[model samples]
Target: MSLSPMTSVVVAASLAIASGAADAADYRNNPFTLTYDGAITQNLPGRVNIHPVTYKLNGLDISANVYTPPNYDPKKTYAAIVIAHPNGGVKEQTAGLYAQRLAEQGYITLAADAAYQGASGGLPRYVDKPSNRVEDIHGMADYISSYAGVDKARLGLLGICGGGGYSLKAAQTDKRFKAVATLSMFNSGRVRRNGFMDSQLSSVQARLQQASEARAQEAAGGKVLYANDVVLTDEQIAKLPFEMYRQGFEYYGKTHMHPNASAKYTLSSLLDLMSFDATNQIELINQPLLMIAGSKADSLYMSEDAFSKATGTKDKELFKIDGATHIETYWLPKYVNTAVAKLTQFYARTL
Candidate 1:
């Protein structure tokens, strides 16, 4: 059984599980490489400034961008938010947009590339295991909390797409995040193990066998195996069954394409992703929680399941953006405005 087809759509949908600014100026002028609308062209005074930063996480260098609010003064205390990008997504896309937007609202925000993906340093690249993803969220919290002007006690978190799943896991016990929220929350493990909507349930055991073989090969110094590495044409994308994947490709492939964002992962990663479930121990996340998703999103079930099981947080709320889809929440300005307004209110009241 080839590992390709099993995860081709699985990872692509996970890509659905999931910014910027520079033009004309040299890369250094806007090293952040944000791609969202109204991105910071230059760090003018009294305006949000993007800071490109790198930090060590578990012996690997992690790349991140920190956005400071207008007229930011390190001497004064401020609430900070840690934004986690979606699976196969880098910090420079929607994550950066949210970071910049949150910063404009007088909050400092940090968005980082996952350790083995994006611009972050890691070997045997594109390894997308559940543990590593959860750790990335924790690492972001660690780095952002120590930043100047960040009031550690007032920290909040916003995770997008697959990042939302990992964020739920991270916030399960990392109470440092006083408030937690997710937009277009995607359960990467659920979709990866069951194949988007459970359409591949019959092939679960077969795929597991292939993943085991891939792991054995990797351990024996054989060539590394990968999946979902194909680039799709316009006709191919339109043929995709789910609106999430159809629009996701357009967002990540063309309209908001970035070199660091990819839809592939190490095939052996299935060994770890299969047994994982984002909702496991979700009751442990006692922090105030807010989950937002498009009312029409094909991935809405994932958010609904996780939200219903979060009984530990009496303060939790599930918000749906009317007329929006999973990928639509990522870039549509109208949907983004509604989501941001709700987030701003939630964080302000909780943090």
Candidate 2:
């Protein structure tokens, strides 16, 4: 639970439950379990079905989950949305929760893992390049737009945490997305360059030096060195600096644990992340935009800053969930419901 920004493989930790999700004993050793609360337990009678899928993105296999509504009819076209997981997350966690919920609301949804992370195929696992992550979003849009029962012209986009930030960038030019929404968006570049809350401004040069050396080592065929690569004890987890990072451990490392989910990215990734900004040309997103974040979230500034730069969208809004922290908006029942409610309304009206 180090808030070092490396553990940014974050998610809404799944809708924070189905009946058996409240009891850990039911799934303690179940490898097939989705690991997140309210996970699909045998595809309920009237619920959506999650179809695990894979497609090529920049010559790599990208893993994804496609959610289709109950009694889905392929003959009839339907609106769709692409849900992007946080930087350190996969399709089965928060991204899946939102996709399933949206599908329940009559929209086909696709959630995919960025290449090199989760179950996706890529070299040097966890590279986390900005261009690659953005390409993942475009790839999702490409696949989902052509999916059965989906209307190519009525597609929407949603990203949670780090994915949120990337979605803004993608929607800027990918006019296929008629509407764009983000929940707890995390600005990967801003945090990487300026540090958490800009607390490490003075040490930026030193960190860059470290990253450069790490790249040199990699070039020399040395073992990969990762940032925030530490195993924490229970007490140590309890002592983490931010609630977002602390609760992230409880979600990804314990309750919502999945074999493919991880927070570690290559140290070389900083070179690209530090230079990329999701809002660099945000004004290009002329589509309807909605940015949601917990009012009490420490990462609220990222959402606010991005929202402010989106002047191109006349139909834009910044909504905050009062009293909820950054991570709470991920899985807390009330918070998740609030976010899903807003998203449903936004997509319904726009798409």
Candidate 3:
């Protein structure tokens, strides 16, 4: 494939699973085979149009999926929302679920593949560079603003997991987004620096050392290795760090898995996430912000901490779902509905 300079090539290669791979053979040839079960699926009365488009960002061609509301009219502008998927996720992941739901609510939504991951463009696939990730959100905003039915003045962002943190970072610099929201937001840098729940702070230096070695190996023409906390086997799932990690596999590895989804990521990218900090500029985000997380989730603390640091006083709200876990918010009906309602209300009010 001849890639445009504006698109990062890394994303195209990483997000695509090899043909005949055991993990996603069914989805490779049939992208639409994955059926989504949600309120949007049941309630949407008009034809839901899914568009495959590309935009230039950071000198790379970034791919995206745009969902237009039923009865959409090019002459009439409507509120727009940009959705960013979780780490190692594509636009077809849970993001599409959220985008389709939001679109059914009369909003035009764009779900984009993050640079270096999914269908976006980047080098050394699955390399999660914080700066590039933030830029990718801005790129989506740029693309959405130009669409015929989109109201650029009323732009909002919805990011899941790592995408949430990047959304925060993007909103800090790009005032174009009038409202912002994040679900199960993961502070990639914090998790990398201190480990989950700050349990591995003592080993941070050692991890950095190993990452340095990995970088050296890559520079020496060695293939980079990818590491994911989730393990697929029954025995590995039994030893997972948290029940949520095992559950995440069920969502990302099997039932909801897309052919483009990958459990692997470039080892060198860990170095970037280890030092990246999105909360540092939370105060700069003057727009209305809604941060959602499960009260019992191990990742909830990061969202809480971010809400505390955010300077947008009256415009910011945090909702902690009582009995839910991190992965539960991804597709669980009860939690996903609550999140969608909150997000719709937040954007409707602020955007």
The top-ranked prediction according to lDDT is 1
Worst lDDT 10-window in candidate 2: 11-20
The Cα error of candidate 2 at residue 341, in Å, is 0.9
Sequence-dependent TM-score of model 2 = 0.91
Off by over 4 Å in 2: 1-32, 44-46
Better of 1 and 2 by TM-score: 1
Global lDDT of model 3: 0.75
Question: Once superposed on the true structure, which residue ranges of model 1 sit more than 4 Å away at CA?
Answer: 1-11, 14-31
In lDDT terms, how accurate is model 2? 0.80
What's the distance in Å from true for residue 9, model 1?
3.9
- lDDT digits (tens) for residues 29-70 of candidate 1: 344667677778779899999899999999999999999999
Q: Over the full model, what C-alpha lDDT does candidate 1 score relative to the true structure?
A: 0.86
* CA lDDT scores, all candidates in order: 0.86, 0.80, 0.75
For model 2, name the residue pairs that clash.
9-88, 17-38, 18-38
- TM-score, candidate number 3: 0.87
lDDT of 2 by residue, 269-294 (tens): 88788788889999999999999999
Question: What TM value does model 1 have?
Answer: 0.94
